[model samples]
Target: MFRQTHIRLTFINSIVFIVLISILGSIIYFYTDNKLYEDVNQSLLKSVDHYQNTDGPEDSQGGKLGEGDQAPKFMGRDPRILTLIWDENGNLLAGENRGTMIFQGNEKLIRPKKYGTLEDVQVEDFSFRYVAFKTELPQVGKITVQVIRNVNSEKELLDRLLLIILIGCGVGIICAVASGYFLAGRALVPIKKSWQKQQQFVSDASHELRTPLAVIQAKTDLLFRAPQATIQEKILDVSTISKESRRLSKLVTNLLTLARSDSDQLEMKKSTFQLDELLKEILQQYEEIAMYQEKTLRLEAPEPVAFLADKERFHQLIVILLDNAIKYTKEGGDILLSCTQSHSSISLKVEDTGIGIPEKDIPKIFDRFYQSDKARTEAEGTGLGLSIAKWIIDKHHGKIKVHSIVGQGTKIEITFPKSQK
Candidate 1:
């Protein structure tokens, strides 16, 4: 589809450019031709004017003569000129003898009023452009003068210019086609990257969700094997199965949310809400879970901080961060939540005294299904908590970062624009 569209657009553009160039070239050609004709006409008129203004009769050696009987002189002496003069009786008066021979059988050449200017005519074997005009003598009879020249050179130049235009346009079209292909390919690179990421996301989601499902299935089968067992053992097995099932369900839900976010199908309702209040609410809900695991959850915000955002998604974002902090922190470790607002943006920080991530793993910790401890498969997460948190922040037009030191702690800082609601 993209290829076809690009080609169609390029073709249309090329046609438009070709038409414009052709129009401009034609305008230039005709203008140049008109100018050439005007210059030639002015030169011919100047020659005629000089001939008409000559004063006296012929010299002793035929040096100069009056306009009535004298032939027009070629000041530039160009060989192309073919001049002629005739009397009223169809007899030759002066000028080139070739004109006399040509007009000997044509009586139209002697008529004063019939003589035309700059007319196309054929004499002998050559085509010529001829101009004829008459001037009356004081005492002698009327005489006609005609000037003729060839037009083959001008036609040759025009033909060469048209050939050049054709060749140049062909080459320009070829280059445009090549460039269009390359530009379209470059523009689609981002789409190709997004597609590859989506494929990886699908594969990772399947692998991560399958593990908890398999655990739940195995635990359920063990419960069936011991139908006659004690109540305590059966209760323990059922509880384990239920926990794994819940874990798998949460993973699937997060996966769906991430997919919706990626496809831009998730709708968010924007409103002004208190960020500190939202964080406090999430902390209170997760406090029971933290206490059950023998961990301490704390909120460090000294005052209320307000922000513009989707209240529900903002709650989910805080829940994800607090859950992660509790999961990674050891029993009796500290988990802190805090928020600060500035003129342009606001920042929320979640710090935990946990088994901090390694330097290399920290960079990819937010990637789907990526965990720092490869050998610690006993952990109960599908490894999508940070990924989901990151997606939520991105959808809100915010940024998140992590600072970690192995065996020391990890701190996650998220910043949201004040106007991004």
Candidate 2:
């Protein structure tokens, strides 16, 4: 899917580039063509003006003006200019630069019928831009002036300009495609990671739920089928069924909470509360469990600190950390819960002298459904407790971190801004 998206983005970029280049190229081509024609027209107009001003003699050749008139010479005159004159009777009477009219049908195209306007003329492989005007000279009858200029050089230049634009457009599109693909790949990296995590979460949840469900089904079936069993055996079967059901329910609840968090729908009811009192109550509740597990539990919060947080979720966070510590600590090992406050921030720490996590697995401890090998074997959990704790801390706008050395101890620290009274 990402590959297809990349291709599509590249295609769009290429098309946009092509259209922009095309517009720019067309503007340049038309502007250059117009300028070239304007220069040629200016040259022809000046030459024709010089001929019209000259004094000349009348001749019997159809009442036309003859050559040999002393026409004023123009400085920097174009050599390709061809001049022709015709009488009012539609007869070709005189011409200048006659040797330059080398193309066939040049003579037949210079009459009153072809007079009065500027036009393009093609005569047997020669191209000409010509203008005709009626003018009368001193001592000469009225005649029409036809001025022509060669345009092969301008045509060649336009062709070359078109080729350059085509080449430039081709190169630009190729670069656009290559760069677009590279940028699209860079952009998709984070999205790809998120998609992979979602898939893994679904697979893990399915497996975890399936385990407890299978156990509940088997235990219930045994209780129903073995009707003749002793009462104690029946009670044990019922107990197994109840435990599995509770485990299944807890897994489902955790999954739901994570789903809600993912959708940004997890709301926290925030209020100011005494931090010391809350920590003390949580520790007292865990005291019995710690004793049963043969682990020493302690709290080291002396000063009362107030904070703004979701009271219930904050309590749940502390419970998750304390429970994890108690579960991992060996018999007679110590578990410490402590809180401290400064002028601006409140810090909480849960340190345990337990089977500490390996250094490599520390980073992934808060990832959903990610359990280390030791955690899977030694603890009965769905591995989502720390994930939930992290989510709660995030909602409270706090930071949490862990430090651990294998077989020695682990320390988890969290910090939040102190509340203003």
Q: Pick the candidate with the highest TM-score.
A: 2
Q: lDDT per residue, candidate 1, 192-213, as tens digits?
A: 6777787788888878878888
TM-score of 2: 0.69
Best by lDDT, which number? 2
The residue-level lDDT of candidate 2 at 411 comes to 99
Q: What digit string (tens of lDDT, one per residue) describes model 2 on residues 327-389?
A: 888899999999999888999999998889989999999999978885334678889999999
Question: Model 2 misses residue 416 by how many Å?
Answer: 3.8
Clashes of each: 0, 0
Candidate 1 ranges with C-alpha deviation above 4 Å: 1-174, 218-233, 376-378
- Cα deviation in Å at residue 142, candidate 2? 11
Cα distance off (Å), candidate 1, residue 363: 3.0
lDDT values, one for every candidate: 0.71, 0.79
Candidate 1 achieves a global lDDT of 0.71
Error of 1 at 161 (Å): 5.1
